[model samples]
Target: MMHGLAETTTGALTLEHIGRRFGETLALDDVSFSIRHGEIICLVGQSGCGKSSLLRIIAGVDTADSGRVLLGKTEVAGPDRFVEPEERNIGFVFQDYALFPHLTVEENVAFGLKKLPRHEARERAAAVIARIGIETLARRYPHMLSGGEQQRVALARALAPKPRILLMDEPFSNLDRGLRERVREETTATLRALGTTVIMVTHDPEEALSAGDRVVLMQKGRIVQIATGYEIYDRPNSLYAAEFFCPLNKLPGVYRNGRVETALGAFPAGLNLPEGGQALACIRPQAFRLAQPGEGMSARVVRCSFLGEIEQLAIKVEGVEGTLHMRTTERIEVKPGDDVRLVIEPGGVLAFPQA
Candidate 1:
């Protein structure tokens, strides 16, 4: 579901009932989502999960076997209509940057302005280079520039065209962690300043959370959940979504009489579920707090690992089958084989159907 007032005030780019296939394998399966103008939407998923395929469809680089893509009110792709990539006026920043090695930065940036006179093309390219804060490297070749510099040059080229939309296909995948972080922040700021509509595909969760106005979690070519980072983390709709977003410790539980009974204790079941049915409940490490032996559920510390700021403990309850992972900020004094208690906060349990 779409969130916030921006989605309603501004019309969105819509993909309706999109489906694509490659022989016997399905790349996209009736996937649909909307991205509002001036909003940055991130498509995130595992490898071979149709994230890139969906981006290509939106860019008009590939046609869907069935479905419609609408930009504002215009139908860009559908059963009877298909817009060519060049006609779509969408800027694409590839993973590799794809700059011309032989050409200077200015020449490369001006490649898309072929229709304009040479003087006008150079003028526009110069303006964009200045806007991206890379005017000093106007005469340098791609190989002469650093990874971050080359990325900026590529962005300048894409922004030079003044496209109605910008599509980035894993743009930060090639850079190191430090460079990726800096470039992403700068690029996001640039896009925001221009109020550009952008769709970025990335496998990195941190990047998706930091760069996107909205995160669209995809799986098997279908949209799972579209929400802000906080919403997705706090209230994941399914087990798959929750586990994909972060590490989760799931335990067997039963929903009965409007309550969920687990190893920890019986708690009020907030979600609607059939009574007397077995379900899986998810608890994140941060959701639990350490308690005194008699204050909470009794358990024994099976293992502990120091993770810099926080300490992770693997605890085992006497009757519970699986180990429960817990994280604490303070250095825990407990050791392996030491009996401790785990207090499952009533608000942290997220239960789903067993199937």
Candidate 2:
């Protein structure tokens, strides 16, 4: 067992080489990470990417076939020792809220305080309800509350017991776009104010970027990259990781003389690339610019749409067969059949090895 002081200094949760298999499918493969006190981490990936499996293993809802889970220096899940979920003192907030229809907001928050004295439980429940800014809805049943209200009640209930760590499984997935954003901001602020450690699973890139202190991107039951939101967006390690976070315009070309020669034009490679090797270059829509007729690569406008803040244009190059979309702030004086020139900005190109 690890020493108590060392554990306190490191974190409250640790997973070492965790792996879980279900018949022919491998859910989690060699997963390892740690979460410290009063920190929030977000796990992000496509569906069936082992994020939920890792959370379940940590919560003790599912056992790992191989590996050890340590909560505060105590081996919660291992070959010889298995600690029950309740004994681990970890709270979980599910996607569906999971509020009991029969219970009021106040009663639901008080549910987990059963071990405490009656008066103390009531006082704690009241405190949490007020902290969540839902004291007015204390008497409302789950069925009567709106989606956002129920979400707050569920969170209040989970935090009422003051668990060492909190796990949220796509908690904002059910709400509408507007409500989801509001609830996310509110919940994140609440957690930070209380100095609560949290691990949340999400498929939405925006949610992962805005809500997490660090974002962990997973693929094929393995972590592909772990970094801050800005790092993940600006410096993606792999093509898959880049495509996962935003729309990538993949241009097929060859790298030569420290530059990528594509159908559009030759552009300097921002990062190192193998000389004279075939690669796929990634460019965001905002990276391209409209140029004069003869100055840049010739292309014909295919379509145009007006977004709120900017205009989206689809242009087809003479040499490049498919349509390429670009976003620009300035409104272009062009139509669907209008011919235009495409200029790729320097240092905007990201090249990866061609598969």
Candidate topping TM-score: 2
- The digit string of per-residue lDDT tens for model 2 on 1-355 reads 4332234345878888899999999999999888878889999999999999999999999999998888867778887778899988899999999998999999999999999999999999999999999999999899999999989999999999999899999999999999999999999999999999999999999999999998999998998999989898888899998889878788888888877788767766654566888878888888889887688677788999988789999888777768888899988888899888778876566777777
What TM-score number comes out for model 2?
0.94
lDDT by residue (tens digit), candidate 1, 272-310: 677888877788788788777578778889999999999
Cα TM-score per model: 0.92, 0.94
Model 1 TM-score?
0.92
Residue pairs in clash, model 2: none
> Model 2: residues >4 Å from true position, as ranges?
1-9, 270-274, 292-294
> How far does residue 217 in candidate 2 sit from its true spot (Å)?
0.5
